[model samples]
Target: MRIYPIETGNFKLDGGAMFGVVPKVIWQRTNPADVNNLIDIAARCLLLEDGNRLILIDSGLGNKQSDKFFGYYYRWGDHTLDGSLAKLGFHRDDITDVFMTHLHFDHCGGSIQWNKDRTGYEPAFKNAAFWTNENHWQWATHPNAREKASFLKENLLPMQESGQLRFIQRGDTSFLEKSELGFDILFVDGHSEKQMIPHIRYKGKTLVFMADLIPTVGHIPLPYVMGYDTRPLLTLAEKELFLNTAVQNEFYLLFEHDAHNELCTLQHTAKGVRLKNTHNFDEIFS
Candidate 1:
């Protein structure tokens, strides 16, 4: 199996929102903000190439939104989903599965795109099955007031319309359930309902995809939960448990939003579990 880092694009978000109640004085040290108090965010997706299946985890924000709609996020950089795929000598049609961690726009927007005629939406990955659990599919489709803005219909409805959407059944257990993708899934509700974090066993190491849960290295601390999380208190407990397991198992965390850091290892510190070392995908795998 081969794993490739697909950088879709970069955008800026309010640092305060990204780091919740964590004081700017603390988070700013790691993810420094610009004059407008916006920090860099990456829509970094992962491509898993196994025998006959080419699975993509998270599609990133596609370029279908209107300028006014995108103005809010302040997107930057020239990286694009198609361009990134081409770099790897692949294309959208090559993807056999799109494993979405959650249905947030930044994560799944690329799942749908405007058709050639500009009449309606279509599945961006024409040949792939879009993956999201039953719980999250309902949560995103019938979104609550707080998360409604993040779960854009344009990014979702088309997949169902195209008849390519598939739901993963969440086991009765709380976390770490076996998935058809040849990895175990760790479900955490604090960020979004049933956000599936894939625990991939690759090359003798377990690599956990850190979706919105622990988005960046700045979010390693237990208290650094995102303000966007529905239940912050629950996040604290979940992070503690996950971090402990990650440390014990020596898992490599793959960050989705972290612009600078791609993968990191955790070490038990006096304060708490902290980043031990950081490396790019090639550096670690090669």
Candidate 2:
């Protein structure tokens, strides 16, 4: 089996919002912000290649939102999902599975796109099955007011409408062993209800996809949580447990939103679980 980091696109988000309750004086040392108070963010997806299946972990924000809508985010990049796929000699059609870590717009927006002639929406990966758990599907569809804006309808619905949407069978435990998509899943509810973090076994190493749970290396600290989260206290507990487990298992974390630091390892420090090392995707897997 092989894995590749698919950099779909890059955008900027308010640093204050990204680092919740943390002072700019502290977070700026790790994730420095611009004069506009925005920091660079990447919609870095992951692709898994094993025999006949080409599974994409998450699809970044697509090019379907209105210009006015996008202007708010300040997206600045030359990277396109198609170009990234082409570099690896693959196409959207080649993806057999589009496994979503969650249904947030920035995470799953690329899964749907406008049809020809600017008609209604359609699945971007026409041949792939869109994956999300039953709990998340319901939460996103009938979103609470706090997360409603992030859970855009256009980014969703198409997969379900196309009859290609699928859900992983999750038990009551926080972790599910051997999910249908050929990986273990950790269900954390702090970021969003039942956010599935994939534990992929590749090349004698376990890579954990740090979706919103630990978006960037800056978030390695237990207290550095995102302001967007619904339950910060729950996040504090979940993050502490996950970080400790990650350090114990020597897991390589794959950051979905971190533009500078793609992958990192953790070690026990005097303070707590801290970053041990950072690596390029190819430095290890290649």
Candidate 3:
């Protein structure tokens, strides 16, 4: 099996929102903010190539939104989803599965695109089955007021409309063991309802796709949770449990929202689990 890092692009978000109640004095040290008090964020996706299946985890924000809509996010850089795929000698059609960690726009917006006629939306990965859990599917489709803005209809409806949408059946256990994609799903509800974090066993190491649960290295601390989360207290507990397990198992965390750092391992520190080492995709695998 081979894993590739697909960088869609970078965008800026309010540092305050990203780090919740954590003071700017603390978080700014690791994730320095710009003059506008916004921090850089990457829509970093992962591509898993195993035998006949090429599974993509999380499609970044696509370029379908209006200029006015995009202006709010302050997107930067030359990277794009199609361009990244082409660099790896692959195309959208080569993807057999799109495993979405959640349905937030930045994470799954690239799942759909405007058709040739620009009349309506169409699946971005024409040949891939778009994957999301049943609980998340319902929560996203009928979003609450707080998360409604992040779950855009344009990013979701196309997959369902194209008849390519699929759900990973949840079980009584914490990890779903029967995914055909060859990864264990870790469900956490703090960030959103039933957010599935993929625990992939690759090359003698367990590489976890750390979606929004642990977005960046700066978010390693238990108290440093995102303000966007519906239940901040729940997030604290979830992070603590997940981090302890990650440290014990020596898992390589594949970050989705960190711009500078791609992968990291944990070490038990006086302050609890902290980042041990940072690495790029190639460096870790090589």
Candidate 4:
């Protein structure tokens, strides 16, 4: 099995919102903010190749949003999902499965695109079966006001219309049962209802896709939750529980929003817990 890091794009977000109640003095060091107090973040996605299946995890924010809408985030980056796929000798059509961690625009927007002539939306990966949990789907479709903006309809309706949308049943980890690169799906609702993070066991090491649950290494501290989360207190509990398990199992965390750091290991520290070490993806895998 082979794994590839697919960088879709980069965008800036309010650093304070990203770090929640964490003081600027603390988070600014790891993720320094711009003069506008925004930080650049990567919409990093993962591609897994196992035998005949080429699966993609989370599509980045697509380029379909209006300029006015995108201007807020200040999207910047030469790397695009299409370009990255082409670099790997693959294309959208090559993807057999698209495992979305959640339906947030930054994470799932690239899953659909404007069709030719710009009449309506269409599946970005027409050949792939879009995977998301049934509960998460309902929650996103009928989103609460807090998360409504992040769950755009243009990015989601296309999949259901394409007839490629499939909801994984709760506790069903057999999504990749036939593949050598099978993953253990870990669901947590603190960030959003039933968000699935894939834990892949490869080469005697476990690599976990740290979605919004742990957006960056700086979020290792228990209380450093994101302001965007619907339930901040629930996030604290979920993060603490997950971090404990991650440290105990020595799992490698793959960050989705961290622009500089791709992966890191956690260890117990006098101040609760902190990053034990940090490394690039290729460096560790190589």
User: Top TM-score: which candidate number?
Assistant: 4
lDDT of 4 by residue, 8-118 (tens): 999999999999999999999888999999998999999999989999999999889999999999988698999999998998999999999999999999999999999
Clashes of 4: 0
lDDT of 1 at 214: 93
lDDT of 1 by residue, 92-211 (tens): 999999999999999999989999999999998899999899999999999999999999988888899889998888763422234333488889999999999988888888889999
Runs of candidate 1 with Cα error greater than 4 angstroms are 172-182
Top of the candidates by lDDT: 4
Worst 10 residues of 3 by lDDT: 172-181
User: What would the per-residue lDDT of candidate 2 be over residues 1-286, giving only the tens digit for each residue?
Assistant: 6789999999999999999999999999999999999999999999988778888999999999999989999998788899999999999999999999999999999999999978799999999889899989999999999999999999888889999998887853322224333478899999999999988877788899999999999999999999999898999999999999999999999999999999999999999999999999888778
Residues 68-158 of candidate 3 have per-residue lDDT tens digits of 9999999999999989999989999999999999999999999999999999999988999999989999999999999999999999888
TM-score, predicted candidate 4 vs. hidden true structure: 0.98
Q: What TM-score against the true fold does each predicted structure earn?
A: 0.96, 0.96, 0.96, 0.98
**lDDT for each of the candidates?**
0.91, 0.91, 0.91, 0.92
As a whole number from 0 to 100, the lDDT of residue 41 in candidate 1 is 95
The better candidate by lDDT, 3 or 4, is 4
- Given candidate 1, what's the lDDT at residue 284? 85
Tell me which residue pairs clash in candidate 2. Answer: none
Q: For model 3, what is the alpha-carbon lDDT of residue 107?
A: 92
Candidate 1 C-alpha error for residue 116, in Å: 0.9
